[model samples]
Target: MGIGGGVFLGPVLLLIGFASPKNIAGICSAFVLVNSVVGLLSHSLQGRVDLSVLFFLGLVVFAGAQVGSFLGTRKFSPLLLQRIFAFILLAVSLKLGIGISG
Candidate 1:
């Protein structure tokens, strides 16, 4: 019933609440970790697991996440990070919209 927490929660928490960006990032990180675990388990139980592809993709995603989290949380100002996040969301939305239309 409540807002599903993930990428959207970070910005909402930062803008509408009193939490710092770093704290919001930490909370979002935990949500991502838990969601990933649950998703993996559900897929595996459904007999849709692909260990080989998951292994390679997980490695790439893990490396990127580490670097991204470090820079996003520690190096950038909150306003700059919010701008970057909005830009990314806009780009992804446009890409999906174009894909859906075409």
Candidate 2:
């Protein structure tokens, strides 16, 4: 599945020391939109698309994206966002490393 360029691109930019949250979010959002559309089309062609699930998931994702876009572009200070992102990554890493049953 296409996880979208946004997922990796924004963090890579940050790691390379880019400090513009607005620019990063904007670029990533665009990439995610394109990737999502292409992915959905490909899945649909293979008869694996679920319209019912997509419809509800799409709504929630749209709302979350809207909020994230606003916060990332305006409310979140760059340092705070970076720290938060790092924490999330760490949490995920630990979770994967330790396994869910632990």
Candidate 3:
């Protein structure tokens, strides 16, 4: 599952079988939420939690999520969304591969 369970699980889940895009998103969101909470608690107890940065980043994430959620459900079709997700995964994989090799 790497460092974040959802990051690993999402693609694996998609590949293992077929599911609707809505179902994939919902499941991944729930998976990430649980993983995030566990990670947060672990860091917080170790006094690694940075409140100031977290607050600012949280706001930015919230804004982006508002637009993203709207667009994902209303603006883009499922096929387009899947293609975008694939592109993002490819980009991330390439970056990671390069970083590791370098």
Give TM per candidate: 0.71, 0.71, 0.79
Query: What's model 3's overall lDDT?
Result: 0.78
For candidate 3, what is the TM-score?
Answer: 0.79
From the highest TM-score down, the ranking of the candidates is: 3, 1, 2
Candidate number with greatest TM-score: 3
Candidate 3 per-residue C-alpha lDDT over 1-102 given as tens digits, one digit per residue, 9 for 90 to 100: 244756567688788766776578768877876887788888989999998799898798789878878888889898998898788678778877788624
**How well is each residue in 1-102 modelled by candidate 2, as lDDT tens digits?**
734555568788877868575676677678878888888899899999988798899899989988887888778897887687778667756776798724
Positional deviation of 7 in candidate 3, in angstroms? 2.6
lDDT of 1 by residue, 1-102 (tens): 122358577777878986876677778888887888888898899999888799899999899999988898678998987677678667756866788623
Candidate 1 residue 80 Cα shift, in angstroms, is: 1.6
Better of 2 and 3 by lDDT: 3
How does candidate 1 fare on TM-score? 0.71
Query: What would you estimate as the lDDT of candidate 2?
Result: 0.77
**Which ranges of candidate 1 are over 4 A from the true structure?**
1-4, 91-102
Rank by lDDT, highest first: 3, 1, 2
